[model samples]
Target chain A: MEIITSNQNSRVKLWTSLQTAKGRQQSGSYLLDGWHLVQEALNQAAPIQAVIATEAQMDEHLADVPQGVPAFQVTDEVARHIAKTNNPQGIFAQTSLPNNSFDSKYVHAGQWLLLDRIQDPGNVGTLVRTADAAGFTGVALSVGSADPFGPKVVRAMQGSQFHLKVIKDVDLATWIDDLEENNYDVYGTTLSDTSVDYKTVVPEKSFALILGNEGQGLDPELLAKTSANLHINFLGKAESLNVAVAGGILMFALN
Target chain B: MEIITSNQNSRVKLWTSLQTAKGRQQSGSYLLDGWHLVQEALNQAAPIQAVIATEAQMDEHLADVPQGVPAFQVTDEVARHIAKTNNPQGIFAQTSLPNNSFDSKYVHAGQWLLLDRIQDPGNVGTLVRTADAAGFTGVALSVGSADPFGPKVVRAMQGSQFHLKVIKDVDLATWIDDLEENNYDVYGTTLSDTSVDYKTVVPEKSFALILGNEGQGLDPELLAKTSANLHINFLGKAESLNVAVAGGILMFALN
Candidate 1:
């Protein structure tokens, strides 16, 4: 094992740059922070480029790292620089973005949650996690949504990223069209004249649920393309529900 | 309006102090960081201590300020100092915490969400917001939960704080016993030999759903006192659901 004390180490510099989207694109990898995420990625056999830890973390978790994976030890200062949290668990991993060649035409069955222009990273991650817990097969994100692989999202996911399919950067309109073509009940969350209360819709084994941007409902084109718009009935004076919470309720209800 | 240019203005210092729990407790007030919240506070007739805004903000929203309220114009630097967000909406208000003399002994007859030791501020806020959207009458926080008035929670709440009763620092165990005494259905989130599937329970007009801590589930004492414990059935590989998301699903399902 090699001990890296200086922040100027080339690997350290590369790990720090992975914190940004541009750097991630250039390097073709993203950093996994903390012990659980790193351990999770390894367990799932994600493409691990390197594993870095403080001496104490390595001492406790080294035996868990599989053979033939590159591992390094970094000083506390370097570990802090690489982590997004205030107090990181002093272990990390670098993994390539999962090759997601997910086009909706290929998604013929199982439940799906779709997001459009959902800019908040935390919301995106929570929605994805909810889809997982609700037993959905996959979640698809529109091109305009926040990076599903971003740090805030990765943290919010809490290892659900490894649990199910997270398809990204697809055209939502096209996906809606494909799901409709496949006879899936594509549900859009909006309360228009033609919309039905969510409870009126029977749960389906294979369907797609679309949640819109925080301030805006689904794009008009996507809304028009959905099989039917659905509304979550609010008995109180609250104007609307939080996007993540609303999606969670819908996922569990519909699936 | 009185213009405050210097950061050292006594009023500015006092407003900045509202950012902390100690300062809020000492001054008996909390800061509302954006236009939506400030306007909501005014709309709901929450106790207003003072209103502060930038020149630009005052110019746009001046008339909306309630008559006789003490309003001041602060410099851009001062506005940022008083806000928790990186790019605030350039307006703020100081309001006294609502007087909540809630003892479950004096209660009964509407939906309630009880949170026991949920420490993440965002989770606490999201759960409260979900409770409002789910048509719950009140949300009572245990002594060990995050402060309901903390900055992060206030931001996550998105004006839902003005929509419902948010009672903080109550004895959760005692509250549970009282609700049970008052013929309320108290549902705890834990799987036990006697816990029922959440879906099997018909939505009730009057019930209290108790959500436990994020990491350690409910306090054993509180969990033991529920009218019944409920479990959410998952069909997928997810080990667990995010506490707020799970709470959202349960609230809509059980209510």
Candidate 2:
């Protein structure tokens, strides 16, 4: 195994760069930390370019690393530098970003989750994980949403990215138009008088559910374009539900 | 308004102590930051021990402060010391903890959410917020759950705690037993083969939903004690839904 002791090492610098969206975009790869996520990447046969681990973690988890993958042993200091959390998990993998494009046929045949500029990394990641749990065909992210590959988001997603498609930077207005044109029952979440209670709508086989920003919610114009807007009816004093929780309820109820 | 510039000031020391579970318990009060939560405390007539704000926040949000409430104007540095986040919302309040013991009659009459040792502050807070949104009567936290008033939890709850009864450190097994004794259809979330799909259970007028920890899920012993165990059916590749998302789905579905 190759050993890396210095934080200034070129490959170490590249691994640390995956912490940012710009770096991930520039390199076309992101870092996955912890045994669970790295193991998921290996199991999914994700394009894992390299594996880096502290000696202790490599000793315990080396069996999960694919035999032909380039392995690097790093000191704890180097591991901590690459990890975003205070407690570094020690095992990390560099994997290529998945292709974000979806075939029109596949988009038309299954449920799709459209996120409109949802910003919280944790919320965005939870939404993707929820989409995976609800059996959505894929998640389409409009501009302004949190980067799906960011470190915090990847941690929250817990490897759901490998299980389904997560397309980013799409123009939601045009995408909604196309889904509607293809006879998909597109539903936007809104709380206007015109919006019906979500439970009142029956689950459809193939539909698109659009959730908006955490605070502002879906844009007024975007809400106007969907087949119908639905709201979750509740009795409490809270003004609204967390977007990800709301998304989960809607997806599970309407899928 | 009392001006507090030194972090060592006695009142400032007291406010800082409220940040921890032990301090919150000993003082019978907790600190709330941000205008929204402080306003909720005022609106709900919660026991507002004191209010602390920067001069600017006091100027902008003073109208919401109740008359005769002891208000302190602190410098930005002192405010940051009291506030948990990097960007402190200058307005804050020190409010007494609520009486956590609910009337047995109240518990028997309305929808109740029982959390079983959920440790994530965000998840616990979101579950409470969702319960509020779903019009549940109150939330009962088991012994090991996150403190409902923790900074992270309070932020995620968005002041919903003021709108509903949140009883913490309760014996959930006994509470569930009491709930079932009163003819409440107590439902426990589990993934066992014998569990029925959540959608199949019709919403009852008064029911208790028990959600478990994020990782371990509901204890098998706890699941075996409920009137019935229910699961959300899904076709996704993800192993399980996030506990908060699962709680939201069940709460909204059965409400």
Work out the TM-score per prediction: 0.95, 0.95
Model 2, span A104-130: residue lDDT tens: 443567889999999999999999999
Q: Which 10-residue span in candidate 1 chain A carries the lowest summed lDDT? A: A191-200
Model 1: lDDT of residue A103: 71
Q: Go through the candidates in order and give the C-alpha RMSD of each one to the true structure.
A: 1.9, 1.9
* Pairs of residues clashing in candidate 2: none
What are the Cα lDDT values of the candidates?
A: 0.87, 0.89
For candidate 1, lDDT tens digit of each residue in A3-100?
A: 99988899999998988988888898888998888988988889899999999999999999999999999988889888855678899999898777
lDDT of 2 by residue, B77-146 (tens): 9998888567897989999999876654446587889999999999999999999999988899989999
Instruction: Name model 2 segments beyond 4 Å from true.
Output: A101-106, A203-205, B103-106, B203-205
Task: Give DockQ for candidates 1 onward, in order.
Answer: 0.76, 0.85
DockQ, model 1, C-alpha based: 0.76
